[model samples]
Target chain A: MSEFDLIRRSQEVICAPGARYRAQCVLGIGDDGAVLELPPERQVVVCTDTLVEGVHFPLDTGPAAVGHKALAVNLSDLAAMGAEPAWFFLALTLPAAAPAWLEPFAQGMARLASAASIWLAGGDVAAGPLNVCITALGLVDKGRALTRSGARPGDLVAISGRPGAAAHALALLQAGRVPDARELAALEFPQPRLELGLALRGLATACIDLSDGLLADLGHILEASGAGAELELGRLPCAESLAGLPEPERWRLQLAGGDDYELCFTLPAARAGELDALQRRCGLELTVIGRITAQAGLTLRAPDGSPYRAERAGFDHFGGYRGEGSPAAS
Target chain B: MSEFDLIRRSQEVICAPGARYRAQCVLGIGDDGAVLELPPERQVVVCTDTLVEGVHFPLDTGPAAVGHKALAVNLSDLAAMGAEPAWFFLALTLPAAAPAWLEPFAQGMARLASAASIWLAGGDVAAGPLNVCITALGLVDKGRALTRSGARPGDLVAISGRPGAAAHALALLQAGRVPDARELAALEFPQPRLELGLALRGLATACIDLSDGLLADLGHILEASGAGAELELGRLPCAESLAGLPEPERWRLQLAGGDDYELCFTLPAARAGELDALQRRCGLELTVIGRITAQAGLTLRAPDGSPYRAERAGFDHFGGYRGEGSPAAS
Candidate 1:
């Protein structure tokens, strides 16, 4: 198919007439560039993430999940910043222009985009390996947006939802075994926790989306904030489906395995009650997994207060520092 | 290398301390998302374009040129909309994290970003096939950005710079022949006509960036504006470097070529003299090679007013429509 045909059909599928930001887009797809209007006094937060076939997802993953995960991951970043996602541009490089594939892929993307009240602004579809790159744009109030560098030594490190279900599901998939429905759903359609992130705003000291598991991603907040953390591993909200795994494997999957789109944030002791309130409001577990410390390096403690360690830190796409029987190089 | 380390090195290289929109960026690379403050009265223009290895460029092309072209093409889209290029997010998927390749690549992208007064806000570096997708964000005053649908039947169609050099240069490179330095530069470092696009904002009726040659790109303007065009072949400004090619080949390169980062727009006859001033002000060709017609299809007229034709209209990345010795499956 011609690029123009792909664009026209794709545009038809993604045009959200009821999108929250529809009126803000002066001109959208079909133009060389999309024109969007920003409200006065708001800061625009932008994030770009890429999901490559076999690298970010399994080679045989469904097109719909691929599409869902593509936008989901980027929105996760915006959620990390307490940003309200309004629009996104998708660049899809596919082996061919298959309508059967694009239909479901775009539907998956549109479903998430509509749920988030965001519009698909514009992008390109080219011939190459199956790859999806999405650039998400969102808004946040001035001085209210969360960042990784805001954690204080006394801040309590908290995470939203069960953080490691996706990792366990991926492991199950790679092992050629059936995964728990919830775990598989977590792997394929991880929620962005947008409402929770919005709630965190001025409440959470710092925030980040967990893509590279809990330990490594939290390490970013620590490194940027010039602080460290100590996590109570027993307090970690691991999926119940992982109970059959060996102790170390469960710990690694929960702490060091990748592909969790949950939010890990830091909150002060004074704001702990506010988080509990937010937990009920957001309908997700808001667990205080640890505390930010003055010392460097991430430390973990078992339920009995013994030091705990993982075989590997986390998945690094380029370095390929992942556990055995795993292949998440995102 | 770890993704964090790559991001760190890349952040260091792309840290434009003196960028035009530096003050507008509340946060840049290293954050979950870059927070940018948009001017209230201006519209944000966004465009995303991707370049795949051995597709957009020769596999042997220098890392710097690849990096330069990666950002340049997206900026060209913003330029087409008469937007003031400001910030961009790059999602680069590479086979390896070799500093040897990255240094020059970052430097090359940095050079253009600095020249255009834009900043590398934030992005992702993943492990995959060599692919670069850039999402550029810029701004244009309200109600003033150019669009493809604004042309009138009587408008004068014009283009800036010689449009055939890049196509000819690629042909030469593919044939294992040395190309003219100027043509090579056109392919490797085609300058986006930002100033010309901005100048055309209030004057030109419609505008587009000429990437897929004159015929195909101009065809977009025609289709969008519900008008047609008649080109005077002899009036086209072909580079002197392409004069040695055969008659048909020369004409094909000039009219049906690709990768010319020039501005093509339609100006009303009343605005004709103003275009002359813009041509002088911009110090570019800005040649009027055709006239928009009330008819519905693009018509080609030879120097003697006879009908002219070419083997292919232009390169379509997915369709792979092109002439012999062409490999631009971009």
Candidate 2:
């Protein structure tokens, strides 16, 4: 199909309920650029992420999963900023136009977009090695958007949901073993935790998504906020899951594995009671596994009080540390 | 280099003025996402474009030129919408991180970004074949954004700058002939008519950029506006440049060339005189070559008033027609 036809057809199937722009979009799709009517007193948030084939996913992976992950990772970034996603632009480069792949990919992406209330405003299609680059735009109230530079010396470091499930699923798949339904879902259809983000607007001091490993992504927060962290391994969320693995493998997957798409944020000690209500509302575990410290280093303590260190580093596309973490996103 | 280091290093060189955000941008690089404070009463314009290595430009094209064109093309889209360029995100995919190519590429892009007063807000880098996709965001007065659907039957058709120089330069390169300095510049460093676009905010009815050949891009405006256009070839802006070419070659290059990044718009006949002052203000010649008609097809006429036809269609990435037009963008 021609590039124009593919765009039109993709829109037809995706925006299946006739065609109408979302409330905030002044114009979409057919224009040289989509126009958005910004809400009064709101700041716009933007994050871009790209996923390449054979690098992000296994060659045997389905197209729908790729599509879901492409938008999901970007949405995760917006979630970390305490923003509400409104629209996204996709720049797709494929070796060729195959309806078999494109159809399911569009459908999968449309599902997430509908759930998130985000519209596919505009994008471009080209012929090249398969690559999906998406730039998601969202909005937050002034002074409410979260960043990684707000952690104080006495803040609590918290994470949403079980962080190592996706990494574990990936490892199982590589070992030619089947993961449980929950693990598979975590790997394939990762949820963005957007509602939790919006709820954290006035509560969390600093935030970042767990795309890099727990320790690595947390390292970013410490570096930016000029603080350190102390973690209790027994306080991690998935104790039952870790019980089955060996000590070293358990620590690596729990502390150093990536692709969780969970939020790692800081809350001042005075407001730590705010989590009980948020946990019930968001329907996810809000685990406080660590505390921000004045000392300038990470300190890990085992259940028996022995110190420990995470061996494997997080995945880096250029650093060649493509370990058990995600082969996909940042 | 690590991905974080690369991002940090690139930002340092790109934002050399001690890393200050533009007035509109509240937060920039080194966050989960950048935050922008939209001006009151303004609509935001967004456009995304991608360039794949060996697909958008010749394999031998320099890295600096690729970087310039990657951002320039998206800026042209904003210009077509009569929006003021502001900030952009770049998603760059590469097989490897080589400073030799990346240094010049980043410098070339920085030069244009500086000249346009647009900043590198934020983006992601991944390991893959070379590809540069840029999503540019701009702003226009509420209800004043130019689109392709506002042309009236009696509106006069106009285009800015010379159209065929870029295509002619590419043709010369293909034929093992060297293009003159002007032609080379047109092909390498296209200046998006952003000022003229801003000036035409309330004047032009419909507008688009010449990236997919003049006929094809104009076809989009006509199709959307439900109007037609009748052209007088003798009135085309590049008469001097066409003097040395064969009659057929002259028609093809002038009417079917892409990558010129010039603006084409429809203005009411009464406002045609406004171009005289606008030309002086923007320092680019604005030529009126045709008028919108009630009829529904483009009509081409020779200088002697005989009918003519354009043969090759516009470039389509998947249409198997990689002809004289740009192998680059839509």
Top DockQ hit: 2
Fnat: each model in turn? 0.87, 0.94
TM-score of chain B of 2: 0.93
Tens digits of lDDT, candidate 2, B60-157: 78888988999999999999999988888988898888888888888888888887878788989899889999999988999999999999999999
lDDT of 1: 0.86
Best by lDDT: 1
Model 1 chain A poorest 10 in a row by lDDT:
A321-330
Backbone clashes for every candidate come to 0, 0
- lDDT of every predicted structure (CA atoms): 0.86, 0.85
lDDT of 2 by residue, A136-188 (tens): 99988887899999999999999998778888888888999988887877888
Error of 2 at A315 (Å): 1.7
lDDT of 1 by residue, B190-308 (tens): 89999998988888899999888877888788888888888888898869888777767888988878799899999998778887778899898789999988977777888899987
> If you score just chain A, what TM-score does every candidate get?
0.96, 0.94
